[model samples]
Target: MWHLSRHCSGKHHFHAIALVTIHEPWGADRVGTSMSSHIEFRKLAAELDGPAFLPGEPGYDAECATYNLLTPLRPAIAVGAATVGDVRAAVRFAGDHKLAVAVRGGGHMQPYTAEGAVLITLDRLADVTVDGGRRTARVTGGARWEEVIDAASKEGLAPMSGSSTTVGAIGYVLGGGQSPIFGRPYGYASDHVTSFDIVTADGVLRTVSAGAEPELFAALRGGKGNFGVVTAMEIELFPVTSVLAGGIYFPGSATGEVLRAWRDWAATLPEQATTSVAVQRLPPVEELPEPLRGAHVVHLRYAYLGPAETGLELLAPMRAAAPALIDTIAEAPYKTAAVLHNDPVGAMPYQDRSLGLAGLPDKALDKLAELLGPGTPIPLTSVELRALGGALDRPPATPDSVPSRGLPFQFFGFAVGGDDLDELGRRLDRLFTAMRPWADPKHRRMLNFLSPEEALDPQSLREVYGAENYDRLLAVKRRFDPNTMFRMNHTLR
Candidate 1:
């Protein structure tokens, strides 16, 4: 147990009373007021059960490596927050010192770091509690989707999580999570959130939900981490133990034919099913299956929670369009659904762009073939198109900041991370231009999919949240964080 109190360390105006361990680099004899600040910092560190690493200290470098290899964090201090108390103390210290604070969970953000900010790595705080009887799961700030999946699977339940299990559950939901398999049926992961336990800028913890603090609840769901640092969230779950899910790989030779067939078939899909098509250029890595190794294949990924026979029958047209080089579609536990999308497990340089489409008309498919098909100038890893409709188009019972509900589909293209960031960004722009004809004029972009570059574009943010929701988000920001303390994530400021 920890409590915040004051102390006097030399000329320092304020300090905390707790166990202290000061690192060598931050010596007391340092010149200027920095010495006094360091003394107060040591006091704050004392309040934490875990050690806070100053620059050049052991474990400092390891704690700074967020998931995205491209983003590097250089903080004067990096704290490994082991508990809710630790997080609160770190925030309070940063507030007291006037230092910018950035929170890290799974650390999957495209450009995950904020230079010169005090980084709070939440890796050590993961603790998932599955209440199977109530069909809910309480996920801590640091818990990843994989942990939630593993725990919930024990009771034949599943959270409305995204394709990659490594993604942080709280961050994903805050950014409006889009599950490749469950999105069309479940709307979005944010809609299932029952409540959020957050520490605001003033170092006060508040439980935000529909009945209590209803306005904050609506904003928190898809507002990113602008108002506060979310420490835990209670999310509703579904009774889904297994699914008829997997990917069908076809040769590049049938790209157009197969995509066209899949598009037509997508029009007939039911709410129980969700599907996406991708043109993937798999590397000759030993980690991949033999059939997919060193192959450029057109993949049709499907997941259906209904009977296997009906699911297979619905997929027959795409299967018959061309001979599948590899078909992994079969009844399997929902826990293994990540194999369908198979997002890269290893850290590497990568860039991506996303846009919503009103419909995948012939013009759109032709553009995809031109830019992402074989022999295109861009060396893309995959150009994916996900079918969106059904529940996704309907308003959730609880209102949220998500504005992509009525879109018919969404497209994403990612390429190998390149040394020349500018050149890579320009090439990605070309892909967006090619699809602009069919792209939704509103140009809604999900926060989870926005790259660091896109996140800075005010026009992009305006289009993403729509005028009214964006205004509402700003209002909440003004109330809870007038100074914008939690501005690291995709921010309203």
Candidate 2:
């Protein structure tokens, strides 16, 4: 019954969900605005152990904003929950009050979903634990990478986390995490998790691991966040912290030559080196160091975990590919390896899309260079290819884990923002059209990078999971979430 509206040109009618107006946990929550919606939310708030935010609250604006900066989002009640009981209460509150429910993990959600629902803010649920003897991290779903990595590194352990330590653990894992140098060691990040504390459609707190709920584990992994709300997860970690991390950026003029050269070198690289070639625009900020500042360049980010000499030797061919405009690659701590990507520290409006290809043929490389290099209207900011099939190819010790296909999950995409979002999306689509022939028909879109509206398509989900696994996920959903009470994403089916 709670209504959510923002002051951005007033609220438009949402044709999102065909919800039912009943106060039951088995059906969809009502979507139409009601006169006593606030009062109903107040009543539900009284029955919960969590703090709820109504419209006009002091912290309302900050709480509802996601990683996206383009769209203004506002939710009715932002529930700050601390315990499993609190999450259960919030779920019941949404069900009884007939309000849509949206879950927030690190507030990095790209597609805004705070329009008409009761937002479940997971920031307060932060928790990170490390078991040094076993080299594992038992982190809460709401926990950020800083907490997970900082704590794990203290015990000489590290997990397959993302470049930006600010990203959420659960969100990154479920969407398939691409580590700093994943291809050489761990193929993908999702294969590291051992267990998940899941809240399914029926609002039940279920513990899913390798032996139990195997199908669910597989589905939840890389299937995207469709089946349930993950509360906590136990993921494997590695020993040591120091790594040879950094990048070498080539000038815009050598974009084609550098990309082709780096591609060939990476193909012959050993498992100890993790590297990707990125096409980036140097920002007009003094924060950027010399050489790389204020210039568009093709950059090669690298992480060699084995040893420094071996690392230098492995990249010799790339060093000879093209004279570097700015080379920062060197031996550095793995904890700071994130600096290689240098993702923005603050939140900005961003739109992401990804394509997984088998190999970058000569023609595909030409088209990529055409769209990414320079003078392209879309400004395809970054083109990253993280090699797959390292230790990540090995089967995990848990059930319902996201499977790591023993093949290169080549990722090529860009982050677009500013006032020309519509133009950027259209331009990227056209560019992708030119490159689609190079894409493997069996390739699946990475949920973390796909457009959210198109992300939930069943066909896309099936593509990501393959038909057999997708059918298996449907059967698992039937058993744990038959009513589809947890209808928050595109991966759910």
Candidate 3:
């Protein structure tokens, strides 16, 4: 029997799992500390084909860097797994030594690094293969969406990937990715996963799909990385060559007007048309276009998989709703759709939170504007509400646990750090609290959006998967990971 923690913070009750004690890598110069009493390090290193970096070893710093700059990762040892066998060896070694383990795909997830833990960096596992005839793309665990898009485009097909091409393909899909435009028509990126090649806690490789290991397959779809390390996955591709997509920016003065109009207009949009309204405070950076740099504006991101003329007609109402300062919306190859949201590419300190809503009533919009509009007390960078409906409301034949399926809109807010982490935290707390009244309880956090700090909270996991799904996830977790060895990202335990 699993005894739950009586003091589980935020209502997270799980089996009592032993915490791995932190110790310097045995091979590194111990200074005063000694590895004289432990197992030989070279013997373990020799078992794996990939390079293993001990603390203070060369390449350790570079390999451990996470995409979220705010996370400070200090793993006792890091391994760059090149083959399936290498991964197996690493997990087995960790289990034998009672060391905790964590896996990275492009190092973009909430950094799960801790002392005495084995960090498996999958940067070398990146291999994208597109089968044009089958209209499917086989993406490795570490492959980024840009590579997936570039490869799929060559075959005249496109993937239902996230807004930023830099995000890891497998990680995004597994965590329930919400693509800006394609979501309305095809549902989420996870819906298109053909299969997954995962390495479980017991060091066995398993191929999961709808027909095989169906329960585990459903859990993997939106279960995050709780069950195992996903080495590779095959995703279904769509027949899309070009799209009418980009952003339309209105001057800061028009933020209120544009948002109100956008909310009302987006409610009536067809499934083919997907849009999001954002209030942005762009930094004065040279990388950004002149119109967006150092500007506070209302930007509407649009993506429509239709003829250019028809897309324009559909968007006509929005164009006339407010006087625009800049309009980049145009017909372009689907590969260029990345520009619609224009997410930042480089690493920076950021605090992010999201909520779901059945509908954005006038009261909610008024509250949102008060909280995130220009000259607000909060130092927020952007607040966006993406419209969700149409195909997104329909579940796949073989269901997965993606959240917010029937919700009409999703509200996301971000506070980028500017030398003050404490202030950023405080501001974000106030921002979310002020807008809680309109937040739907049924809406939960998507795993991809979870920060390292947030992922550690079991209550957050319960919120992400919900009560019924959370209980079911626990059952699946016990089946594959009886000891909870894979308790790294958004852990079930």
Candidate 4:
């Protein structure tokens, strides 16, 4: 067991922790403090021993490499927190030193300067422990959706996570997890979260849950990382041993026809099914293989909990609507669902914005078709629209935590595999702005999918969180994070 206490090495006032059993990097360090300021830091390192990466350390580059693939991010400090005690030391040191402490999970944030503050990397803490009987797992801040799914799958369960499971668990849940699948029947992934072991701005390790810190718990669900450093999170598991999951790809010739059919058919689908469409162009990578190598395809992915016979019955109309060049849709497990969206696993430039459309009206489809049809200037890989509502409309548990989700569809306009960040961002703005007319007034942009450029612009937040919820968030900031340490995740301040 690791015991957290206090110590001082010169002026540094870090938490002193002692560990009895664990790995070496995670064992107590009793020989590193030379000064009083660093004494506390050393003690804590000993208590909950883990790798402490100071400036010029060997693993520093890899630890801070979270945002290295895309955004221009440079942090004065990057500590690969080994344990909860390590997190406590870092928090205390930052608080005492009065440094802007920005915590990073996967560092997927565009620009990586949401609020222009000091950054902390937590990528090394990816440990997922599952309890099958209870159907729960304590996920690390660095844990990704893929890790959670793979682990839970071992126990014949799944967590409500995003399409790109590589997105950090804490960061995604805090921003309100809206996974591509499972949301229809199970609700958002946030609702399944049991608790959070967080290190707040004041350096106190607190556990927030439904019965524990209710208000903070409520706010933290969709609040993003505006309160503290979430070291670990306890989330519920879902039972899904197998599923009918795969993707349907339509050639560029059927854009208008296919979209119209999809728009019409999607309106009639039952809650047992979860499906979405993407208008995309496959990258010209030799390793990719076949028809998708260098062609524009309208991809449709479907996930049905029932058998193939029934799933085929439901998908008949969509299948009949268009002639697919690639029809890989078939019976598969949750493990195979990754092929449905063909999400980029190896990191590259990822920039996009999410839209909550009232519904895929004919006018909106026509607009999207016209803009992205065959010869469009927007070098986009995929423009997607996820089906929302059902459990999504109702708050998981805390009724007031999630603002009423009014829109029926959550749209994502994304461009990938390019280093041109500025160009990609501008293209997204054009698409979102063009969609303004059909986009719902109550439709809040999924903050996680928004571009950094759009992080500002006062009029936008009015549309996203709504004027009232936005005000509530501001009040939350005023109360809990007035100093703005947690404001690094796209804050207007």
RMSD of each: 9.2, 5.4, 7.5, 9.9
Deviation in Å, model 1, residue 370 alpha carbon: 1.6
Question: Any idea what lDDT model 4 has?
Answer: 0.67
- Could you tell which candidate, 2 or 4, scores higher by lDDT? 2
Error of 2 at 332 (Å): 1.7
Tens digits of per-residue lDDT, candidate 4, 93-196, equal 65555455667686363225412233556666778999999999889858877788889999999787777666677788877776666767767778888898
lDDT of 2 by residue, 291-317 (tens): 766678887888888878888888888
lDDT of 1 by residue, 411-440 (tens): 888766545666766888898888888888
Residue-by-residue lDDT tens digits, candidate 3, 292-408: 678888889998877889889989989998888888899888878755788776666566776666677888878777876767777578888888888888888797877667776
Q: TM-scores across all candidates?
A: 0.90, 0.88, 0.91, 0.85
Can you give the lDDT of residue 89 in candidate 1?
Answer: 89
Span of ten consecutive residues with least summed lDDT in model 1: 12-21
Give, for candidate 2, the lowest lDDT window spanning 10 residues.
Answer: 1-10
Predictions in order: lDDT: 0.76, 0.68, 0.76, 0.67
Work out candidate 1's RMSD over C-alphas: 9.2
Q: Report the C-alpha displacement of residue 340, candidate 1, in angstroms.
A: 1.8
Q: Candidate 4, residue 3: CA error in Å?
A: 42
Error of 1 at 65 (Å): 0.7
